[model samples]
Target: MTTNLLTRTHPRDDAAPVPPVRPHRRRRSLGSRIEPYLMISPTVLLILGLMVVPIVIVIGYSLMDNTITNPTPKFVGIANYLTVLGSPAFWGAAANTLLFTVVSVVAHMVIGVLFALMLNSKTMAKVPRAIFRAIYILPWIFTASVVAVLWRLLLDPSGVINYLLESLGLIHEAVPWLGLPQTALIAVTVINIWSGYPFFMISLLAGLQGIPSDLYEAARVDGAGPIRQFVSVTLPGLKPILYSMALLDLLWTTQQFTLIWATTGGGPLGSTEMLSTYTYKLAFNSYQFSLASTSAVLVLAASLVVAVFYVRRQRKEERR
Candidate 1:
């Protein structure tokens, strides 16, 4: 009986299979999880070394009286800022900067919107529209120096523009386009508008294209006229893009230097001298680095104010 029981128990145990062992799970440390940031360490270092360092230096220098000829910089607290604030030249430059930014941004938006609308029209030929867009963008692609030189040539008394005008009996004498103060300011403003409008046009055109054609079709079916559709649908759709472009244009125009420098050199009794040009002249030409820095700080403050206002307006509109 005992032998039989042992044999039965051994058979039952043999029929049962062994369970497979579970593999061990490896735990990742915090450093391993953040390895991606480690991979981009070089780029972060480069930005800090190149961009951040220079900006810090500029900020430091801005707080001190560092003349062009001086080897050492002396901290003068806020005295330099007070001097710049009190200067009539600074006020004039500030006014001119504001006028330039406002006029250029307004003109850019109006003209750009018109062009984008025309280009977005179904009746326009694709090839011709593309050519027109390319031509308009050419001015923006050209170097600032080249554009300045071209404008200088065109605006000169003996240039083709004046000669053609005189030949057509449009004028008895060649106008000194850049010689007079008012004319010089107008000329600079026109150049700025021309150079800047194409960028805004392209931006608005992209925004226009992003809008669904179905919306327009629906509007049409609902008895919405073109004017009504544009006002109610298109304008609202383009509001964000328009606001962004306007702010960008304002900032760019306010800080414009190369074109103005190459074209007018802030001449004709500083009539065309915006804040940027004024700051440059103060720093390099007049050897007043601290004062220049003060002006630059003011320019930065103005830019911040404009940007903040636009952002707030955008947020309010979005909430509604």
Candidate 2:
């Protein structure tokens, strides 16, 4: 038996060990490669749907004779664009929108910076600081619709504004704030400033907080007063934040809708008409979707111009 076992071929001893196949190895490599894309897919799809899709639709509509009355959209090329550009109403709205954006941005910058400075002051107690912060940001908490409605009630002829004015002998009679064409645009612009200033204020406050306290001390040591210190240290430090905030705020103010709509509906003979409100009027009220789309395209183009200018400015600043 021993001789037979020795002569028999020992397969196990002579053969090499085989490695088992690992199916999951390839799967793991693939998962690692695709994981980042999978994570960002939702955001990409959302942006495509929300921003790109609407822009494409607007462009398409601007080129077509599209309206509610006309179920079938016929391609009209640049006719709609030409018509919109030639329309007096369109030009008027554009002018108003431009003026409103400029005025509102300026007001926001001034008021916001002041508020931010006051908030950053060292004299305020902790409780008062907290309270002031809450109060200052309160406007931002309210929706544009709510703000518009509230302000409308206040500005009504028989409302608290006129009542107080009469009581103080400021005006012998109730003033027609919204009814007068002269005051309508200004009124809406003021409301826009009031509601929107908080955004700038918050941004400026953040910028202020990030500034090193030592810079102020150094400025003071160099015989700088409050104005000089602000001009040199504060403004320089806030430059980037200010630029970003102002550009974005300009875009938002120009596109503002709900507040102006709820207050005046571009009323008093379209005195308060803006690009945003005018677009709304053209679309739903007038059922001129093609012209509305044209307006939208123009506004988008203008906004792009602003964005390009901002990009250029930022590049120059960076180079400096």
Candidate 3:
């Protein structure tokens, strides 16, 4: 009986086990939840104010014939959109943009992959690899405006490139790269490729690095040649990254303005006039704000479509 009494706990053991103060705990939990929202609110507001609000204003303006000179804005209700769609100049600009974007992206992918493979090679010494990698990305470090201006100088009749070509006996006459309509598009494309490939190189190299060596080893063990192995193993592994880079590069190339502007200003008979250039000309040069707004909306829509495709592709890749 004494042992049982010693072992038995009192009716209230060690004072009542404290129930957490419900109100104070609830308040603390609420505060924790609210803190995250508070931290993000500023960024949310900035995006809404800067990006979303501007886009909304552009859309609204697309429906109105608004001008800086005019005090009143007349509602046109899709007239501006139709005008952009029907105009031959707009069509020409669209074609130019399409060609520029497609060719530039293709070149970027090919060159980016080649550079990535070279840099990622096990045979490459670290110092040389690092130096070459830095060189590849050097052009991208410069602003587009600076690059455009520099290239404009280099492509002039007596400029470095033409001089080099002449010195090499490749051409008898100094070819004006940005002056001829035929060469103007090609020159700008080359410039875009040079400036843009670095982005692809960085992304593709990172993707290549993420791939497992075991896969390559297995391919080799199966008697696969380098080309076959690359086609079979490397390409498949890098597919998702390639897709993502392709979409982003396409969009970026579509929006290219500075280089074309600073170099040729979409000139040589409007042969290099991209949609971005066209929009700029309409808004500022032609003082056609409504038309520019319509063009801007078209660009936005195109971007949105590409983004949707990218999202769907990502989902598919994730499943795979």
What local distance difference test score does each model get? Answer: 0.86, 0.91, 0.92
RMSD after CA superposition, every candidate: 4.8, 3.4, 4.2
- TM-score attained by model 3: 0.90
Tens digits of lDDT, candidate 3, 105-145: 99999999999999999898999999999999998899999
**Backbone clash count, each prediction separately:** 0, 0, 0
- The prediction achieving the highest TM-score against the true structure is 3
Candidate with better lDDT, 1 vs 3? 3
Ranking by TM-score: 3, 2, 1
Question: Model 2, residue 51: displacement in angstroms?
Answer: 2.4
135 in model 2: Cα distance from truth in Å?
Answer: 1.8
Q: Global lDDT for candidate 1?
A: 0.86
TM-score of candidate 1 on Cα atoms, chains taken together: 0.84
lDDT of 1 at 218: 94
lDDT per residue as tens, model 2, 1-320: 88678767454576778989988999999999999999999999999999999899889989999755688878899999999999999999989998999999999999999999998898998899989999999989999999998999999998999999999999999888988999999999998899988898889999999999999999999999999999999999999888878888888888899988899998899899999999998999888888999999999999998888788878988898
lDDT of 3 at 165: 94
Which window of 10 residues has the lowest lDDT sum in candidate 2? 6-15
